[model samples]
Target: MTDPNQSVLSKLPNNVIDEILIRLPFRDAVCTSILSKEWRKHWCRLPQLTLDSDFWKSKKDLTGDKRATSNFTMTIHNIITRHSGPLTKFTLCIQYWEIYPPIDNLLYFLSRNRIQHLVLKLPRQFKLPPSFFTCLHLRHLFLQNCLLLPPPDFKGFDRLIRLELHEVTISSKLLESLISNCLLLEQLVLRISDTLSDIIEINAPMLKSCDFTGDMTTICLKCVPRLTELSLRYYRKDWKEFDVANFLTSNFFESCPDHLEHLHLDYGVIAKGQEIPKKLPFDLLCVKHLCMCIYLDRDEILCPLSLIRSFPFLQYLEIQMEHNFKKNMPALECLEMEAFPDVIFEHLREVTLIEANASIREMQLIKLLLAMSPALVKMVISPHRFLGKSTIVKTLTKLAEFECAPKAEIFLKLV
Candidate 1:
């Protein structure tokens, strides 16, 4: 005779049971086998399976015998062989990849089962198997510490909506072709480790956002008409003097979408000298939020200032400054020299200055913004972590005298 409580749980809708099991951790879902024989079937029918590092840790804790833990490959084989339902989402973040063979068979199994969302973060970098491309229905993909060498006849991820590649290796041609063919892709994130020597062209027309952090030869926004937000964090390995302040990477913005609204950059040493162009060819009239890192150590101040001049309609500005102790830099040179032209910021409202020490460069930048943005609303000055209270006091005294808009409020925040 069945227990009364067991009868009620077993009577629950099959879809409801699968929903509960998929939401639980992989170990917890497997352990539900002890609940009842019916629950065992529900666990095996879960639509989403995530066997990550935490799953192994949980098993070790439960047994209190880490040495006798089950083999990962065998465990996965058993689960896949016993599963009775199609899996739509699968994630495997594991260590010790060298001990196992290629995962071609596992990926093939998932491909046949209609897997749509996949994340694989392994211990070492390995080329993805041919079976990886067989999962043609994938909508979202995340890969780390791997190499992408798709088969020669491969088409592309036609249904993919998002792709994230972290510490992955892919040739320039492959990366461009992979993205261009993903016609529906909307978001992209690339935290690359490889030094890309060839230009990466992004032609994703439907793409809306991109955040890339790596040094590349250059990039071209070939056909990104819908892109709105762009973020780049790059530092060239060789900072030798160049004709342009941005190491010739400024051409990437030549195709900036007229609808782009937010821009964030962290490239350092933009200018080696004060000979930067007085004005760029284009203006980012649509951009309202601008965040950039400027280095005063190399006198990179003028290049950034010139770029900001192009944002005639900017609303919010955040500057993360990098300054080193340089004895040769003048202490009190006004920014109003012939190269620096003054313009009233018609739409500028809020400004944030990070890593502020009372250096002449920082003080003058603050004063320049105060005098320029007649429509300014508020300004926040966050001093360097090691800045002394005496220095802060002196800075505050100097700031109190700067001329600003009547409605503008300045605040000094120290943390």
Candidate 2:
């Protein structure tokens, strides 16, 4: 029997249906419009527009030409014009095929609508449409592989909150202008070419999270008071040698709190093994939550243990070890332990270890847990890829048997 609620639910307004469809992939939602007359016109008015080549086909049945790129562009323009509302999002992804025409007209249309989120992925070079400078409401922007011909000016998006660039090239002046103009930006990610200096000029006063990825490493922070979270991944060398001291020497976190509540740094160091940086003068006295993904060889220095102890108020810690360390690696006994067991926090609550290779090598962690003054509320242990279930269970049983505080629980998974 059909439920009475089903009929009521079906009576809901078409606008609500359009809202739901906007969140789905552009191709799938657009095709649903053909199923019913009521659905056909609503899709054209969706605030979010996503165009991807994967949904298009070359066939005599659908269109005379399989590669009708012009038709696709025209269809997109019609959708925007019919929608008659400020667009919230516009994403265009073009992959593999190179038959596409210039996208300047599309960008201009999107900019004119003052889209809040925009993502464009293209293969070749293209100039930013003149209308791009007027997109003042844009909050999130992502551009990949679209080589900016003259390197468009950054003054375009004044309210951009988040920006991501991958495999793109930009001049330092443009980069500086972009950062300076997005004064309210909270998160920023940069992955670019090596020729471009690994530099970031952050003038955002309300900036909070920052991630600098790739081999390129130089970064300069000018005036960011509210900034807290920072992530540095795949750097060429230690970022400590940079002018962090100069940036903070006058006053560390003066505009923000004395302590950062969370920090993530996945970077390479000068040491051969998983060694911690030599007792650096810089201090993160207020960090409370930390997630670290660091790469270290079997015999490298063990820096994570010491690093955690430095955070006086640390309550939660998550560590993801590199996968390469688990294969044909040397014994853990061969490494140093001076900094290992002493790093457990006095107020620590949860500790999670991802991709741990050897159970024997994990004894150092067990020793650290046993030495903790505070009750470690929860612990997660994930064994290496090759570790057997029986071995992991036995190892966990042994570790769990060790003396622990009143509120401690251990979790283990073998992968």
Per-model TM-score versus the true fold: 0.82, 0.80
lDDT of residue 242 for candidate 1? 36
Where model 2 places Cα greater than 4 Å from the true spot, the runs are 1-11, 53-68, 124-127, 149-154, 193-195, 236-259, 269-276, 294-296, 325-344, 413-415
Return the clash pairs for model 2, or none: 58-66, 198-218, 259-286, 273-300, 273-301, 274-300, 274-301, 275-301
TM-score top scorer: 1
lDDT of 2 by residue, 190-299 (tens): 87544556466567777888777754234556776777777665543234322322332333233335535777756443334323443233556777778886344534
Model 1, C-alpha of 184: deviation from truth (Å): 0.7
Cα lDDT of model 1 by residue, 184-227, tens digit: 99999988756686889999999999988777345678899999
TM-score of 1: 0.82
lDDT, candidate 1, at 146:
83
Q: Against the unseen true structure, what C-alpha lDDT does each candidate score?
A: 0.80, 0.64
Worst 10 residues of 1 by lDDT: 61-70
